[model samples]
Target chain A: MTVENLNNINNNNAFKVPENYFDNFSQEIETRIFEENIKKQFGNKNPFKVPENYFKDFKSDISAKPKSNFAKIIRITKPWLSAAAGIIIIFTLWQFLLTGIENKNNQTGNNDSLKSKNNIVIANYQPEINTVDIKYLEPEINAYIDETDADQIYEDVNEDNNETKINSDDETVYQYFIDYADDNDYTELLAEL
Target chain B: MNAAASENKISEHISNKNFSEAFNLIVNQYKERLYWHIRKIVIIHEDADDVLQNTFIKVWRYLENFNQNSKIYTWLFRIATNEAITFINNKKKKEEESLGTYEHRLSDTLESDEYFDGDNAQLILQKAILKLPEKQRIVFNMKYFDEIKYGEMSKILETSTGALKASYHHAVKKIEKFVKQY
Candidate 1:
């Protein structure tokens, strides 16, 4: 080739690319750099596989199984069970108190009825003698008798009996009378009338 | 490791299957310059990308047997140049047959290489280089464009220094005639 012609290659400017061809190039090199990095990283990582303690945190969960169901019941239901026990105790105590009160009330009713009967029986018969000695009668009967003056009590009772004085003694003797009174009113006594 | 012996230690580490260390060394030493060099040769961003991958693959595969006889960059350049040449040859083979004469052959290569997105005169110059023989084309690229010394070029090409200088000179003369004509 001619040396004068060689001016063309030195004027080698002929084969130049666009102005910014190399300046503002694409990220291909960066991509290759990354690809190389990944290759390098994976190449190193491939040969290593350690026996790591993967399940360290799972120990508590495993241990808690089956036994934890029992424990959980205790944990979750402790307050509820305590509340139930408290309610049962309260109900039992309430029932017991109610039954005791009912029994006492029933006894009071029975004593009232017995006292009414005693009053009726005493009404029909007057005392045999005046100033009857209290020492002679049973203490229990005396207590049951309400410890009032017997003469005024029995007189008030029999005078209201409406007995027909058949004989002189009949007025003072035990009279046979029928009672048809709701409140044990001794005044309700009747002979034939 | 400490900087006390990072160079020798890093080189030793590269030989011990320590690819990460080798990669770090490659990045620090050759990354920017190699990228630009490749970018200039292949032109299109994507084609350069493909060539760069093939280049590194070759480098990694042949790293152990690397004689450590030359500059690491020259070793790398040989691989890059080989990959680029193979790619262009394959590309040329795939397309239609090139024109018979040297001048027409150069025109066909530049016209065919979609990556030759250069301005018109630059395109014409590249076309002229493509018309030369394969050895002349490589010598022309190393000397004219890359400004690489013929000594290093001789080492990478495994050619005698005298033959490289002659090839470069002949390539320059052809390119000069072509550029002036264009």
Candidate 2:
């Protein structure tokens, strides 16, 4: 064989391809190119889609969630900050409870003064009885009566026979005295007795 | 049609918004040459297919911006070359392997390659080509096997013709020594 023939033999490809590769290759290229063009066009036009007014609805959806400043603060601070907030709340509530109790006691004292003011009627005072001296002796007399036996007191009163006969003279006299006491004239009657 | 007439028709069709027709014409005219050019660099049919398709897609995208004075074939080859280099670099990075190690792996891959039906001499030639540095290998493949002129290679590689010639010469010397040893 000549040098040219040898060169030609060596130039021939020893590599092989799949059956009918060349026959179908051009067709494959066309198909791929066609698909690729479609893909490029699709890419530019956005293949993904959403419902109508999607962006408007999306804004509404985001707005629908709790967006108050307080809620936001709680959400952001929930990790460790919320514990401090809870402690502050508990301490404030305890302080409020303490102050409320103190205020209630002060109001009760004021109520007593108000009741005394309302009850004082200077026009109805009895000139015969000096109620100030009686008020000064009332505490010591109550103490002496509390120390004495009730039966002994009643026996002492009965020992005054003239006073008992005068009291038993009218059977309905006890009912009249009780009715007068109910009318709030007991202070004057006590002074007279 | 002649290349000039085809370029005019493609340009006219593209200007008229007939992209599919223009792009299809471009693919039909250049797909085989681009495929082989990419295949030689990547050394795998499947990877070559991917790079070729990517090259055409880029061409289609940048068609409007194409310089009317330059030949479409030259522009297409340039895109195919860049895409092939980029693909190789990305594949190497993904595998976390250096270019030399990747080339060695490709050499091993060629042994078991079902697509490669070359005999001992052809396989040795391929092995010798793989032993060259990546840039030299590309220069050698284009000049030695594809018989592409140094000036055209300069356009595709964006290097001077002088530099490409030197690269090809060095690659040929190395391949000769390698083939002699094998």
Candidate 3:
């Protein structure tokens, strides 16, 4: 069909919604919201909660002792700087989170989605990232990955673990991904990636 | 609703970092409005839900930057619309990348246990809507489902009322024809 005709088809339908379908949407949203709430309060992937000791960490006073000239700069830029930093941290964490998720999606071929007690298992067992961590026997996979690459990744994870002791449980998945990558045969390809 | 209480409630939410308070307040006030606005475009509850989450997340992220030049609710509606449009656009891109037509993707989605919202008629209407250009879809959604007047929408969207009204009419007529055909 022509573009005009398709537009006509869409205009003709105009997308009428079922009456009151949205009426109970508040309740459904509430349930999901509570889920988000629990996730946040427990520090389990809740995007709303900033961090523990946030008030203490973010506390600052310009007027209390601001004779210093540089403190003025700090005062003027505090809100903007903090907001920028928050955005950066959120973005960085999100990238790391998605990489973990993508690795999981590659492994096991979407099986865990059928069973989602909080949708947690989509990481860790993902063979692609795990293959990098775990030691592997396959020669073709060996030809693909250098054994040292997994060791470097392990070193990075150890550093990361020291910096942050307990993160959201997804780190458990990250841990598994590391282990899998260390042992898996195809880890060399991962280095190029 | 007491506007003062609502205002205080939002403030409390900001103070306590209580997202649920803000989320509940928004849902109580705007759930049906936002849902119908979203439902008109996406048609499926699941897609709507994902878009809705994006909308709320946008709200949470941007609430600190709210300028108060327009109502917060209107700003939220704009974000919701943008998110839905982006989602649909991305879905189309994904299908194209997978070497599938829109019809095939729709069937695959429907056959799956994931996205059906128990209303086939609603689905048909949304499929028709999927054909409209993004601007027409937005105008149609705001004017028809949400019953927003052109003037208010102009203020929200920073567009001419006449242009919006014309877009709405074109959108309406196209949808009417499509619905009539089915």
Clashing pairs in 1: A8-B176, A9-A12, A9-B176, A14-B121, A14-B122, A15-B122, A16-B122
| Model 2 chain A lowest lDDT segment of ten | A114-123
- What's the TM-score of every candidate structure? 0.41, 0.47, 0.43
lDDT of 2 by residue, B1-182 (tens): 87778888887866665554666677766676777788888887667755665676567446656876777878999999988888888778667896598888888888777667676566777777789898998887777557788777888788987677567656766666576675
- Tens-digit lDDT track for model 3 on A1-193? 8999998998798688655547645654553454343223232210111224522332111111112322333354323222222222233345546655433223333432212111222223342332111211122223323433533433444454454322334454345444433554322221111
Better of 1 and 2 by lDDT: 2
lDDT of 2 by residue, A13-72 (tens): 797776666765665565445334322422212111223552333221111221232244
Q: Which ten residues in a row have the lowest lDDT in candidate 1 chain A?
A: A129-138
Q: Across the candidates, what are chain A's individual TM-scores?
A: 0.15, 0.21, 0.15
Local distance difference test, candidate 2:
0.55
Where model 2 places Cα greater than 4 Å from the true spot, the runs are A1-193, B15-17
What is the two-chain DockQ of model 3?
A: 0.02
Best by DockQ: 3
Candidate 3: segments with Cα more than 4 A from true spot: A1-193, B2-24, B97-127, B179-182
Q: Tens digits of per-residue lDDT for model 1 on B1-182?
A: 43325445546655564543454465445544565556545444455545555565456445546665455667777788777666655555445456434335445655555545455545655566567777887776666556777778888888987677567666665655565554
